[model samples]
Target: METKKTDKILLFKGIKLLIFAALSLFMGPTLMTMALSDKENSLYIPLLIVACLICAMAVFLIFKGIKIIMSSMFDKK
Candidate 1:
């Protein structure tokens, strides 16, 4: 792969990682707040769980992307 394409992939991966981190931070608190509130909502718990799972997946993807970029740096000409 060309260096430019590789760089773009790296940049995209980094952005995804940042997005996931933000979602994790936001969702955790939002869910907690909703659970504590008196109002009952059926969807909140499931959505919260999904959000947590997505956060975990995002972290995994970030690491994978880093590894790919590093390996690409060492690719034989």
Candidate 2:
């Protein structure tokens, strides 16, 4: 019988990613709202684009974080 130990390093990395995702989750919507509030401004398009990118990054980070955490807990080393 084999005992599986959690991979601390990977778990920590996953947690860090999740924290960043949380920040981006908040920031993306805030930026989008700001962009929409000033549609006529020159910065509107750029802000909107950046917001979209941040939202995408937040989703990606969330998935990656969960995957990494799962792997750390279950993967055989």
Candidate 3:
């Protein structure tokens, strides 16, 4: 069984995290837009909750991407 190399893992994780972050970022904005567009909608709370969650996930992903990128490019550890 061949073990995965660190650089390969970093590259794969960086790309995957960035992709997921992008999708989550889009979802968050769309949800927020939906919540804002219909002020009278009673489901705003749930939409807001989900939107916030998505946005938070996006932020986390971005941080992880940064970590992966920095470590892969410079840290060497």
Best by TM-score: 2
Candidate 1 structure quality by residue, lDDT tens digits, 11-69: 56666665666666676666656655633677767766775676576567657666656
Q: Model 1 segments beyond 4 Å from truth?
A: 1-39
lDDT of 1: 0.62
What's the CA error at residue 20 for candidate 3, in Å?
A: 0.4
Candidate 2 versus truth, CA RMSD in Å, comes to: 0.5
> Which pairs of residues collide in model 2?
none
Please give the ranking of all candidate structures by lDDT, highest first, separated by commas. Answer: 2, 3, 1
Clashing pairs in 1: none
lDDT of 3 by residue, 1-77 (tens): 65434576777788888999999999998998999898889998899889999999999999998788667655544
lDDT of 2 by residue, 1-77 (tens): 98999999999999999999999999999999999998899999999999999999999999999999999999998
Model 1 RMSD in Å is 4.9
In what order do the candidates fall by TM-score, top score first? Answer: 2, 3, 1
Can you give the TM-score per candidate against the true fold?
A: 0.51, 0.98, 0.79
Per-residue error (Å), model 1, residue 35: 6.6
Winner of 1 and 3 under lDDT? 3
Candidate 3 TM-score, C-alpha based: 0.79
Q: What's the CA error at residue 33 for candidate 1, in Å?
A: 6.4
